[model samples]
Target chain A: MLDAVIIVLRETLEASLLVSFLFVYSNHFSVNKKWMFLALVSGIAFAVLVALQLSEISDLYDGTGQEVLFITVLLALSLLIQWINFIVIMPNYLKSNQQLLKILFSSIIVLAISLEGAEIIVFFQSSLANDNHFHANLLGSILGLGIGISAGAVSYYLLNQLANTGVIICLFLLVVVSAGMASQAVSYLMQADFIESGYPVWNTNTLIDERSVIGQLLYALIGYEATPSFTQVIVYFSYVLIPSASFIYFKIFSVRKN
Target chain B: MVLSKTGSSVKAKRLFLIHLTMLVIGIFSVDASAKRLTIEIEIKNHFFIPDKIEIPANTKIKLIVHNRDSSSEEFESYELNREKLIMGERKANIFIGPLAAGEYPFFGEFNQKTAQGWIIVK
Candidate 1:
């Protein structure tokens, strides 16, 4: 049951952080909350489908196909959001483009949160179905959900303050988080040998083990890996660079043109 | 100088693309071979027996995780990005890399503290 709490907490906190970030952003942009709520509903519905088809999905592509699908979807969504943010949102931010941006960004959040939520639900259901610790597991999960949601609320408040001071900081955080997810997606592919992963550049296990409390938080936040391969490092940096560069270019050069 | 530079750069780009394509094919062929490499791992008392495993670089290997514990366990690895929930007293078959030489870490998600191991590819 303790283990159940720990696992649920980890997955829940990740999804919660994404939700809170979206919430704050939408509030600032004056977008209707209804659209976001609808996205959440749709995402949950999709997750149910994923959970139901888990076995079939797991069996595809010599048993590595599920990871392939996950990585592809995450990478695609990250790229799509980043591309849209640069090409559409940044330039038109001061103007009232809230409606379109609201829908676009909300869908991105839905994709991330729903996939994460699906995994948690699947984990919970499996554990419940197999084990006799029904009471303990249920209690643990409730506690985990409470803690995770509170953490998200706190972070949202702090980040909202930061946004008030400077929107660029928020933008940087958003882009960095997206890049981190992309790097993680690449690591999944590497684990399955869907992509080439070179030798480890270094191991920081002694200094900061990824299994530690702080390490897990950092992993969720910034995609920190204690031992990263050369390919992962390259992917991480390129993911961070390409979108950020586009942002800077559009911010500076496009504004100049205006 | 500009013409030669552009020509060389274009050639380099094409060469890199060719290498990437070959890498993809190499991985596919490695998977298709009839020779199946199998490794057995046992989980007892929330610990992985023979925690450190080594396999040849660039080959598909099958891993059989036998969980002796009466409680459920999830074989999870951030490095390997593979997670499987094996019900207590059950077993799971996990297929891993034709990988580049590196160390990959995995743990039992239900018992992370006691159940840790590594896969070393050489």
Candidate 2:
């Protein structure tokens, strides 16, 4: 039962946190709310498709297909975040460019939800098939989902309370999330042998063992890894630095020009 | 800068295409090099058949994980930075290594207490 709770909570929290961020972005822009309908329908539908075909997927690309697909999704989300950041910073630069925003928001939701939702779909499929823990697992699943959604909701409300500042915070968060995704993508690439799995840059498992509950939560929330390779560290920092530095540089240069 | 007055869709589209090309190139390049070792680990009754396995340090390794039980389990490892879902009676391939000497722990997320194991890199 506890296993079920933890699995669902982690998966749900990961997807919902992304959704919550996009939701706030949508509110700030006054973009159409119709995207939720599209995202839900497509996300769940694709999740079911992915879950059903997962075994086949694992078999492709000399059995590195899973990592390949995972890498693509992570990188895609990161790229979309870059676009979203630009939109957030220059909302009215192109008044009629709301279409692009709509597309970005919708794509992020679909990709984020479907990737995480596939795991949940697989969990439920497995759970329903097993009679021994059906009742307990079902209860845990519900509890996990409730808590996960509630956490996302609370975060949404918190950012909303901050009003204008919330958008700024969200912009920062989106950047951080992209950095995390980049790190995760690098890990997958290393696993696939597309990139070398060099020696780890550092290890901090003693401080907060990655297997611990907090570690897992942090992993889901921020892509935390205690023993990251040198490649992963370099890529992660590049992500965090490049966008932020570019944004600040642009801001300072524009102020001077004005 | 994409939203700047001088921002052009052609450049954005080109940048997107470059990223896509690099990704596609990565996919095709998987065959450019071959791993030196392949390891098999089976999960029967929610436990890794060989709960402890060893490999040489700094060597890329391919892992074929076969699930023999009637339940699903997630193959997760913090040290190895790998995770995959293996359905009942199905198998998944997990590639790892080229690492420094040490022990890397992994577990089945669905049955953590019982489904634990380690990779000894030496």
Candidate 3:
């Protein structure tokens, strides 16, 4: 039961950070919250399908199917995050263009929930099985899930409270997380043997243990890895560079035009 | 040679694009031709069979993990940097390699106390 709690908590903390970030962004723009509802329903549907078909998924691509699925999803999610960065940089983003941004945010929510929700569904499927420990396992899962959602709700309000700095803060989080997810996509590619992963350039495990709770939360928010390969680091920084350059370009040129 | 501001900016942008392309290609040099060594690990009752594995350093290897348990388990290793959930009575493949010579510990997250092992890259 304790292990169940830990597992869900880890997955949820990782997922909810991004969800809250997107929620804040959508709120700032006054885009319809319908995306949140649509995302939840579709995402859970997709997750249930994935969990049910996992055996087939495990066998695909000569047993590399799981990695392939993760790579596709992570890359798609990363692309969605990158789009958010672009929208944030647009000088007129706040006052207009809510419709397309609405779709983008909705897609982000769908992908995020689909990715994390599958694990929860799989875990719960086992927990709900007939056994004496069923009650304990179910309780643990509910408790863990509650903690995760509560943390996300608290963060949403806190970021909204920042008011003036909210957009910048959200944008910065998006940039950092998107870059990290890009690196994760490449790692998945490497895991599938679709690409090679050179030995890690550095190991920071001594400084921040990856197994610790703090390490888990940092990973959720920033894509933190104690040991990162050369390809992963390069991919991460390249993502960072593109968005920063776009923000700077818009800031300078938009001001000049004004 | 002196040029207009637009010409200089255009040249710089072109240079940047070319370098970016090179960097991308350099990073993703997929080697379909290289054969990979395959290793098998069995998980029975939340324990890694052959709890210690040895492999050559700096070589990619395919790890076939078969879960023989009646319950699901997650194969996680921070040192080798991997996490995969293999449902009960199922199997999965994880690729890890070109690692520096060292002992990387791994465990089943669902049963961490009993499910433990090590990969010794030499």
Candidate 4:
């Protein structure tokens, strides 16, 4: 429930931000509100339909297909987080108010929100996999969604209040955290044998069990692995640490004027 | 901000009423026949119409399980000791006892993906 809530909140907030930004932009250009709302609703509806389609597809292939789908989603999510970091999050640190950047952010936000809707479907389907009470599960999901939307609204309001400097720093940090967790999730799917094998670097399960609460939290947040294959660890580090260090370095030294 | 204008107040009120009416309709429709519980089970591509279910205690339910997929699904709850084999575009009926309020899990034995649902006797 908590995991679902967090994912929903993050995804919804990203979508809300995009929509609000578009509203503001539309006002500047005097775009038709009716058309704008229609487009937005259609996008959301499409996302929901895709999610339902994926759930149905998962049910067709036996358990193996579902496992493969999970792996694919994790990989896609990881790549998306990285792409967002490289495109929107990083460039913001170097310049202010670039029109192209704004357009890119808006587009990415729409894409992310639509995909997030699909992810929500997957999450709910998985939750119901073990149980069959449609009413109960539906009630719980509705409650979760309500909370998520509230959180998203609050986060958007908060983001608007923060100073530009703070927003920049916080946004960058958020991207780093999201990227780290995404990378770890992908590595986990790979290790689970849902995906084809990559090289194994080391095994450190003896030192720390990944199943422990603290260990799992670390793994979710920072891509910590006690026993990771060589390629997994390298991929994790390269995706997170390298870009993170470079981002910090560039922010502090290279882009001093901005 | 433009929506806050006086002229738009009427439009806003109308919109609010429409939304309210829809909400009320949705809620009331759900409670239409208290005894005739209209439960909807989603049949997706690869999974059971419903993976799990919960019910109120001692309630007679008209279990409306719909398999919206091409593949057939079976709804079986071991605790309830009941199984309903529902084929594609079909539904099965099982008159459950006045079960006590608790969690009873069910699933599809053949297609584990499509076979799962539960009854909550609350």
Index of the highest-TM-score prediction: 3
- Give the TM-scores of the predictions, in the order they appear: 0.77, 0.87, 0.88, 0.45
> What pairs collide in candidate 3?
none
Stretches off by above 4 angstroms in model 2 are A91-94, B1-35
Task: Compute the TM-score of each model's chain A versus the native chain A and list the values.
Answer: 0.87, 0.93, 0.93, 0.56
lDDT per residue for candidate 2 within B17-41, as digits (tens), equals 9999999998668755553688998
lDDT of 1 by residue, A34-136 (tens): 8878887888887777766655675578766567667876787677557545644365563566666676766876787667776777667655654565677
lDDT of 2 by residue, A70-177 (tens): 899999999898877875665245367788888888988888888888888888877776787788889999999999989889889998788888878888888878
DockQ of each: 0.22, 0.44, 0.38, 0.01
Candidates in order have lDDT scores of 0.74, 0.83, 0.84, 0.52
Compose the digit string of candidate 4's lDDT tens values, residues A1-258. Answer: 443444344445445544444444334333445554555566577677756665354444432333345445545545554554554345454244344434444444445455556655544554555354445545656765786566445644555455464355444544544455454455435323334334335545566655455554454345556645455555666776766776687668646866
Q: Comparing 2 and 4 by TM-score, which wins?
A: 2
Q: Alpha carbon lDDT of residue A119, candidate 4?
A: 54
Off by over 4 Å in 1: A87-89, A93-99, A130-132, A254-258, B1-36, B42-60, B66-73, B78-105, B111-122
Stronger candidate by DockQ (2 vs 4): 2
How would the candidate models be sorted by TM-score, starting from the highest? 3, 2, 1, 4
